[model samples]
Target: MSDPWLMPDGKTKVDPFVEECRLDEIPFPVWFAPYTKGERLGDMLWTGGSGLKIASQRMIDALQDAKITGYRTFDVDVRDHAGNPIKGYVGFATDPGPTTDIQNILGQDGQNFVFIANQRVVEALRAHGADELDIRPYDPSEFD
Candidate 1:
């Protein structure tokens, strides 16, 4: 049986990843706050889409560079007053491996925003900010 939400035309469910992988996809309000500078696995929000074009452009350019690997994007839920994720936004991070040009993006903001890289990405994201980090995984069946 197929899910009712599935399209009547039998269109397969598309993964959110398909959108982020696009070369032209640009996210907004992306932040680069401070992160724990050490050996640890973590994630970061490359874009929050809060009307900040500069921040978003920096992240996009970095990601576009061929040097970045393990680049993946996920739909992080940042809710507003009504409890809805702000539109035109998404979060991204690379695997726990060093790469080039990452510093350019991180260093660009300086103290204006924390340079959230690797280990520090999660903490910096969850820290005092309008964009909340919804990195925690959810399994609907587990709740059911």
Candidate 2:
């Protein structure tokens, strides 16, 4: 698959900041730059990849419980830079059927990060030189 990092024409990419995190070792703190129009928190940590994975599994479980007749669901979780709960995370199934085609476009990895925060916090982080954003489909499923 093509590298999402190089495709910026509104296509999503992983937050380099999250990838740089040491998921298995030390704590990872990421600052969210508050620039969007309508958000609450100022700074926040996009979920680590592992966090996303966990959330994905939960989403799948929820789908199963509801008897949703679609792609296999998944779950993931993430914390903010200050070790606070993340806005949300996302996941897609690996089933190679047309029903799961959209999931394929979400990235074969079946994982993504969605950060949420108030504009002020984002502004502060930008002022403080925070870089690498994991911007993508900032949906309620992941951010709400």
Q: Against the true structure, candidate 2 has what lDDT?
A: 0.36
Off by more than 4 A, model 1: 1-58, 65-71, 103-144
How much lDDT does each candidate structure score?
0.34, 0.36
Candidate 2 local lDDT, residue 98? 42
Instruction: Please give the clash total of every predicted structure, in order.
Output: 14, 22
Q: Per-residue lDDT for 1-144 in model 1, tens only?
A: 855323334564322222233323323232222233343212333223221111232333345443343344554444343444444444443322255322223333211122224433334334423233344433346535
Worst 10 residues of 2 by lDDT: 21-30
Candidate 2: count of backbone clashes, pairs at least 3 residues apart or interchain: 22
lDDT of 1: 0.34
**Which candidate tops lDDT?**
2
